[model samples]
Target: MNTQFVVGESSSSSPHLSCDVFLSFRGEDTRKTFTGHLYTQLCQVGVHTFIDDEELRKGDVISIELDKAIEQSRVSIVVLSKNYAFSSWCLDELVKILDCKQMLKQIVLPIFYDVDPSQVRKQTGSFGEALVKHKERSFGAERVEKWKAALTEAANLSGWHLRNVADGHESKFIKSIIKQVLQEVNQTPLDVAHYPIGLDSPIEDILLLMQSGCEHEVRMVGICGVGGIGKTTLAKAIYNRIFLQFGGCCCFLSDIRSKVEELGLVKLQEKLLHHILKTKDFEVDSVAEGVNLIKARLGSKKVLIVLDDVDHRSQLESLTRERSWFGSGSVIIITTRDEHLLYGLTTSEIYRAKLLNDNEAQQLFSCHAFSYFSPPQEYVELTQDIIKYSGGLPLALVTLGSHLQVRSVKEWRYEFKKLKAIPHGDIQKILKISFDGLDVNTQSVFLDIACAFHGCYEAEVIETLNACGFYSESAISTLVQRNLLQRDWPSLVMHHLVQEMGREIVRMESQDPGKRSRLFNPQEAIDVLQGHKGSENVQALVVERRALKGVKLTTKAFQKMINLRVLKIDNLYISGDVELLSKELRWLSWEGCPLKCIPSNFPVEKLVVLNMRESNIQEVGLDFQCCRSLKVLNLSDCKRLRSTPNFRGSRSLETLYLDNCSSLKKIHPSIGNLDSLITLSFSCCKKITDLPSSICQLKSLEFLDISSCSSLQTLPVDFGDMQSLRSLFA
Candidate 1:
């Protein structure tokens, strides 16, 4: 009996080929029984095998097409029966097969169906009889030569010869072939390790760094490595260990790249101030002012600071200066990828992050993939194969293994084939392998959140996604499951890198560049707000583009935004139009806006904070009289301003920042009325002379930073009245 093979048909809509195995067999001999059984067995094992059943046109040369399919496949299976050599078309396919074997190094497996090895090799018995007719036909001798060579090669190669095997034994034979294929597939390079949970070498190294103590002026320790190599994790571990030991500590995980991209270094310095000083309203006018403040205030404290994901040397310079700027016990730990940055820092000590070994990679993969310390019994063989294929890379191993965790035997086989052939550098290949395992809707949700919405409110995302016709709570759940998106209390945050990848995918899905919605651009943001207006689901608006002229605002827009809390509009060209803002607004930034002055009737009392940095306003006007309830006022770079607004009567002003009002020479002595003031910053007011003798009236002040006021010499005699001040910069 001749063994027959059939090729699977695929849809044209999906251009990418998916099958791992392509089976080639002559149909006439075993179309109804043996070949059919073999195809079923292949599918049952999840082999994703393709066998052709559709008839080929007579005299149609399928050589080129078949060769292309063979190249696309990882392995090719040939079923040999007695009459297989009779067809000239089959002979031509065999010729291409030998070519594939030579050129592409394609894997080929031959199965003999109740045919003697001698008969196949010499074209004897039924094979010989079929060749005689070909010998009598056109080009018979040349055809015979090729057939004899193909049979010889098939006979000599390693293969299974079934002699009169019954249908009951077919499963055993198929299983044997599967075992061999899986064994070959399982030779992947993976690392496996066994150790107590939550204990690693990096932890010990961090402890040692901490114990070394900060005897030098500026003790800087840098932890450098690639992304996902556990740099942040290690930094967090260290921070947790030592946070209680220091008198003051702050960890900033801001994305330096995004911050520098959105607001220049000068603005980032202000942000750092807000974090370090423990106030949101603080700002610094320039890098020079920031550096001076750090030296004068944090200079003598035994502080512990962790700057995670530091990408630029300038960021480091602007943040931490000489050892003299910090007290003897202060420690600063920086995590980054650029060794050059570490070398450029004022400190000398550095540690290079290394990739995990095989044992560690396997353990990490197994924990994520199988949700245990080891692979389950049923998937042990396949898990070993997956680990090997991941090549000891923990990220790939965990990503792929997690994808294959719940799949069946056959599914694993199919996945193994596809994964083996994928290019190593294809991040999508790794991510998709995991993503495809998610339910279709969950995949959609992941892609949407990863692409369009990040650092967005959870309730808003759910509502927006649901309104857009994607109602998949399960998908959102799956995203959280896969660590693609995280739910932080009420908001959803995507890792910066994952969001970037998601946008890349979304960009790939669209051809029109203008249709791409940008979260950063001011005009694009306005369009988004307009599109979703009158809906209570909107929570935050980050505007980076300048608002257009004559843009009208109505109470309806503000009234509907009951949940809105943060309204950031930088580089806006404000007009004289009176706009009623939501009283519920907690954070507002109007940097680089060209407003001549704030609205006289603006409700400043309800505002918890206000930032008007880099605006063209020459004066704060008497509008400051109504801001009795304000807590933070940032006027860092309002260069056109010639005087400080009188805040001596404002009792609720807890934090005041006026870093770069260089033209202002005096502050109203009535500033002493702010007894509730806890933090005050005036780092770069070079023309300022003396602080109010009444400044000592601020008995609640906790931080007084006046580092770069070059023309000013002494503080008020009553400066000691700030008894609660734990931090001071001169």
Candidate 2:
């Protein structure tokens, strides 16, 4: 007896002699002979076998040791005899086996054992009779229910089950099951491909560009538009188009706002290097060094690179240099909201991406809201109203439409009314509705970019966050996985509207202007900087009544934040003695501050705008030499400003307003250097001017308002160069 036990134990435990065949049978029904024949055949093939012993176990309970033995076995051979469900322990074992299968992703092979699967599922025939008997027994309904559920679950799983078969062919079925399992173990799963959002006709253009080859210097295509108008979508569409055509290509979807807030650009550069080189390990310690390395490695390869959702021109300069940095045939695609961002790059290479037309918007909306090609009869009116509110913006349309999908017409109408009634502060209110559905961490990151930082460095944010004792890279990664935060070229950026909306939330929460003054606590600062926390307070550090005086900054100081939507440091000083006018800020407003000039090499590319509307500045120098991304330069009422600077390289300058510069005389001759200039208003600049012939070179110029330029008389005869001039208010 001891020797028999030893043999059984050795068969079950030995690695080489492990159970090659496990018999799964109801003890009272077929364990006596049917399993015996199967075991004999398996043993003949030098396979170890495990057969449950009914006598070894206590009454009504399955032995714990037996359960473990069954779980560890390589394969289970279930005997579905007529009386299978009669044994309660058998039902328990079957449920455990199915649980293991699901948890471990194990292979399961079922045998019909002279009974059909249909009977097992429907609990008909002998199986039904056994369940009925149990229900009628002293055992309660709950116990019977458990057994029924187990049987139903096991029967539902996809596996091999036999019916109307004999012991003679049992070996053949077992061998076939083993062979199939082995084959499955050897095969690898395929990697999932990313789907490009908003792909359409633009794909054709990208394909054509690829087919044309490197004959001409590789062209850089710029897709410029307002936030959420599908700039990133169009670029993604283009990327997907060429990804298959080219042997080497990389799409860097970095958001400048989020990167500066989280990891900084250094980590982003490292990721870019690793992805481009196809290496698992790489180091990019700084932005300058990373830029150099990227240029060196990518300079020779005829590759396709895409930088999506850019907010700053500095981001463009930092990532893709002159087309010369790449091979002759390489292609670079950049997407941004600010048209001024395309200035430093070639004008001929830029493409102003427009929002989707009514038909397209409606179709996109219908896809999300109705789940059909068109709106349903009941919700048609409400859908149209919702579409109108979206203003042909794809992101807004898709988001709002998705929320309304499958909802009742009443719900749709109510939502539409609420959206229409709400005042438009920033795009964040609309975005927050979507963001609120995300996990807490994602919401925190979204608000961080909207409130405290933009164009952030990923690594710096991470490092600063580590100091604050908030380590949740996984949570930040999860946000990226969900597409809430995106990588925009070398840095990270939030959607323009998203940032705007986030700031709005921060402002709303900080109802008291005084509370806004002390919001940036160190912990809160790190959260705001690294995109891990939302601002609960606001602190506008005003410099001076005439010039900003030193104001206490929150412990979380701005070190590497690159993108800021609204920076109103009115009359605030950096130190008690030094002036703080030289800081690189976007949307800077020193209304009454005593300041002279902006800092040189101040990363002007990052400013999608500059608003110094009401400032007391006498010497207004035109040293905007590096502010390539300055789309709108508002020097509205600077009465002391006398002469504009030579903006030769501000090629992306779309709108230049020198309104009310009463003392200003001669306009910069290089003002005509703007090829992409759409709106040039020298309104109220009473100083004399015989406009230069170079102004005629603005073939794409539109809305040229020389209104109130009393000193100006005859128009340039070469005005024929303003072919695209739609409204000339002279």
Tens digit of lDDT per residue, candidate 1, span 644-716? 7766457667778888877877787777778788888888889888887878887888998888889897878
lDDT (CA) for every model shown?
0.63, 0.58
The clash count for each model shown is: 20, 54
Candidate 2 segments whose C-alpha is farther than 4 A from its true place: 1-199, 205-216, 423-730
Compute each candidate's TM-score over C-alphas: 0.35, 0.36
Best by TM-score: 2
Lowest summed lDDT window (length 10), candidate 1: 3-12
Residue 245 of model 2: what lDDT? 26
Q: How does residue 621 of candidate 2 score in lDDT?
A: 51
Q: In model 1, state the lDDT of residue 495.
A: 51
Candidate 1: list runs displaced more than 4 Å. 1-494, 498-523, 526-536, 545-563, 621-629, 648-651
